[model samples]
Target chain A: MTSGLFHVPLWIELVAAATGGIQGALFAAGIRDRRIDVLGVVAIGLTVALGGSLMRDVVLDQLPVVVSSEWYLLVAAAASLLGMALQSVLTRTEWLISLLDAAVMGIFGAIGASKAVAYGAGSLGAVLVGVVAAVGGGVLRDLMANRPISIIHVGTLNAAAAGIGASMLVLLLRIDVPVGIAGPISAVATALLRIAAVHLG
Target chain B: MTSGLFHVPLWIELVAAATGGIQGALFAAGIRDRRIDVLGVVAIGLTVALGGSLMRDVVLDQLPVVVSSEWYLLVAAAASLLGMALQSVLTRTEWLISLLDAAVMGIFGAIGASKAVAYGAGSLGAVLVGVVAAVGGGVLRDLMANRPISIIHVGTLNAAAAGIGASMLVLLLRIDVPVGIAGPISAVATALLRIAAVHLG
Candidate 1:
């Protein structure tokens, strides 16, 4: 019944999905040993783009937005195709991919936490949901590819960034901040933290 | 709203979860190259046991029964531990594990489809949900172990068995059959089909 509470502008969600889709496709294409065909790449990409939001909705006991919304699959599939087309160029620029990945994670984390809060989950639950939304896609992709889960394995501080951002939003909301203001700030904070972690390491 | 509609006796659900957990743990322990630790084995076991119900609840937009019920985790963990202890003996007898796996899948499929119909999903959706519930655990387990998904890869008619069982249940219910009779019959049909597939192969 808490439908539309977590709805950001369609463009914003599309941007997040596109970035995630592209990143996922690139990641899949990069696997030399794995015989991932075009369909597999697309499936992996869509899974990365939409998996977080799907998990978030499921956890909130709501109909998954990806399944309900008409535009979600179209955008994700198109983005995946674009990513596959540009795999050669995308693979060469690791830094750009990293930056986009961080941004996408931030966007997903903010939306997930906001939705959880709207659905009356506790602060801790909201934070956990946010992290799951941020990294759930990557985990699915890794699983499908038969690789170590990036979040659990030794890798970038993916979960940490999402957690920090989600916690900050929760703190802000507790202090009477509107979700409109809190959401974007949380996303930017997550993105910056992720970028900083990548650079520092 | 349909909270109590799919409520089987607690003991029946427990039996399914315990068997699934034990089978999952045995499967995990058999993977010599994975080196899954105690915690990992337990996690995988719980996933296999509870994952189906969780997915079913999520799809139906209801609170996940495994998370809501206190007994679920305790039973799953205890069964997993028992499985690990019996691994050496279990390994020598692969037939028993396969039989148990088939039964667990059937139980999950029957329950999942029943719940989906209770929540007003269409017949196709119900069947799909049942297949997902049946195979979802194995998929998760395979992912955690960094192995190819068992259902998608060549081996058994996993998804096919679940689909047939779920469809049979849906047909029975539509034809005015009692759920108590329909559920068990569908489950038994699934188990027999799976066993037959394995034996023939």
Candidate 2:
């Protein structure tokens, strides 16, 4: 019975994990100048998606969320595999990659901020954690790829968009809007912001 | 009198810290892309030197080493400038960058592993911590720069080198080797292994 109510968040989490994984795989295969097999691709992808959250939990003196939760692992892996399959079928388009990156950043930023608040971190700390968490997976991927981080030096509006989106989400929560709506709203805002930036560019 | 004994470690730490910083700056400059500016270069360098240590401390539930010590900041900053300066002079030799990277990796692995062990981690845990600490900073830089992590999925000897070097250091320490010699031995081992891998490559 409890599982019924829990499925919504569970589904979201799984999707989020998969999104992260797919991004990582693309980066490894494309940027790193190597062909990552299915296992390597999946491992890298899932690690990136969950790395930030897992790192955050460990830093906060909790068991890493992915390690402790079976659902997180299963969902993340499934989602990544799904993404890999989709990417295989879909036409390779630069615009699509950009859009997905932006969308993921938005959702992740909200996830980070909300998770921080859930853990009772102060606002400033929450923001820091949120930003890191949102971007953390990408950062790990870039590191593996032997390059500089994308958000920091890239002329793109990545971090700025994420911060703004996160702020709005946190502000809404302070006023008691339902948590469920906040995540998607913030994610959409981030996605739109990035997509618009690219369009305007 | 007591402060003098403590000062010894601090002095050694300064050299290690600076070495790390300079390595970071040079790594950034060596990328052959003129996209990053001075601020980005320095920032990337500094993060590589400090990021892993900070993450280690944060995860271990202790105040970060940078937060507690002023010298860490100073050494890292100075080394970053030195690295940039050195890169300007040394870019003629294409392979020196790799050598510098291996050197930094070894020292960091040793330093990180030793610190983790001191914090009451088991031998395996300490070795793992050390490898992470050594490479963590560079990983951060790569990510920020949107590059791949040098440790994972790159088929490089980075983590393995770190693991072996740190584990040896910890083992020597446990067997009552004087603490003074352990640090250099581990760092040297790490550096040599990295350099040897480059040669084999």
Candidate 3:
């Protein structure tokens, strides 16, 4: 669901949305004091799934791809409902959730930076936009849940990892690497860094 | 500033930005444990002054006026610095701050709703946009400070007042009232409601 200017595969966007939705639903369900209903959980999930892309497009001054694409909402809602239904089983698999979160962050970071680059922003600006897009959804989720912002909190590697990936993408593009190749490289590197931090730290 | 599709006087936009800047500076100064430097405080002030407009424009799929206009940043920075310099004096004048805050919220709400209406959004959609615009800055501030969201907190009249003002603006416009008249009436009503709630409650 990227802008028509870019040519990311539809499946990639759907996967990103689904993963974000599942992670967000799990997060909302974990909050005990909020007394959030089913609809609230789904809404939070949708926010997490699309908030980043929405922010990215907003910063780029383009129409929000999420609003125009019906697939995003439908997939996010289904994934969120699935997450809610299997909360007990899914809670036991923390590693999977972490992996999903890391992947979502990485994908969004790559997409955002790429968009900025395409728009002719300087490297630093592209990186900044990418990091914002990477962490925007989680920021919204934490704010809604009244929790400390995860990206700004002590010991969190989110923004750092996102920045590293975005910088790599910018560097690769500068060196004449094709975007299709550069984007995946950036995403994988970011996810690995986040995954390593979580398991090792 | 409203979108190019609509015309709001430049003075009104500047006043709103200045008031928001001052209020934000006062707020950031009140937070004792953050160890926020002068630059941090100014950044917070800018966020409060421009965040709502940025969000409003993003939702409307229009370029953010804050990003495009040099006047907004200049005025907001000057007002924020002025607020910081007058911290002690400003803190003592609680009623004045409250009045300014209410006015800022009202103006932003009216502007946001009018933009939505101008874009041909339905009445309920217009009201939603207005409420989001009115409370967005404060929400961002609270999130940054890691405080409970003020708009959603029990006993707060912010969203309720904004909704009433936005609804009123929509109704007035439907009756063929000029936007200039409708906007001010809505703003005044919202401000009065907020002021009354603070004083009487």
lDDT of 3: 0.78
lDDT: the better of candidates 2 and 3: 3
Runs with alpha carbons beyond 4 Å of true place in candidate 3: A1-51, A58-131, A144-146, A150-201, B1-5, B9-11, B33-43, B58-63, B66-93
Q: Give the Cα error of residue B18 in candidate 1, in Å.
A: 6.9
Using DockQ as the measure, what is the rank order of every candidate, best first?
1, 3, 2
Model 2, range A74-153, lDDT digits (tens) per residue? 66667667666766676673555676678678777777777777777767776776677777787766555555678766
DockQ of each: 0.17, 0.12, 0.14
User: Which candidate number would show the highest lDDT if scored against the true structure?
Assistant: 1
Instruction: Report how far off residue B38 is in candidate 3 (Å).
Output: 5.4
Model 2 misplaced regions, further than 4 Å: A1-33, A36-53, A58-201, B1-8, B91-93, B152-155
Q: Lowest summed lDDT over 10 consecutive residues: which window, candidate 2 chain A?
A: A1-10
Model 1 Cα lDDT, one tens digit per residue, B82-157: 8777886644747767887898889988888787777766666577677767777777777777788765343436
Q: Score candidate 1 by DockQ.
A: 0.17
Going through the candidates in order, what is the number of backbone clashes in each? Answer: 0, 23, 0
Best by DockQ: 1
- Report the lDDT of model 2 for residue B114: 65
Per-residue C-alpha lDDT of model 3 across residues B154-194, encoded as one tens digit per residue: 33787789889999998998888889999999999998888
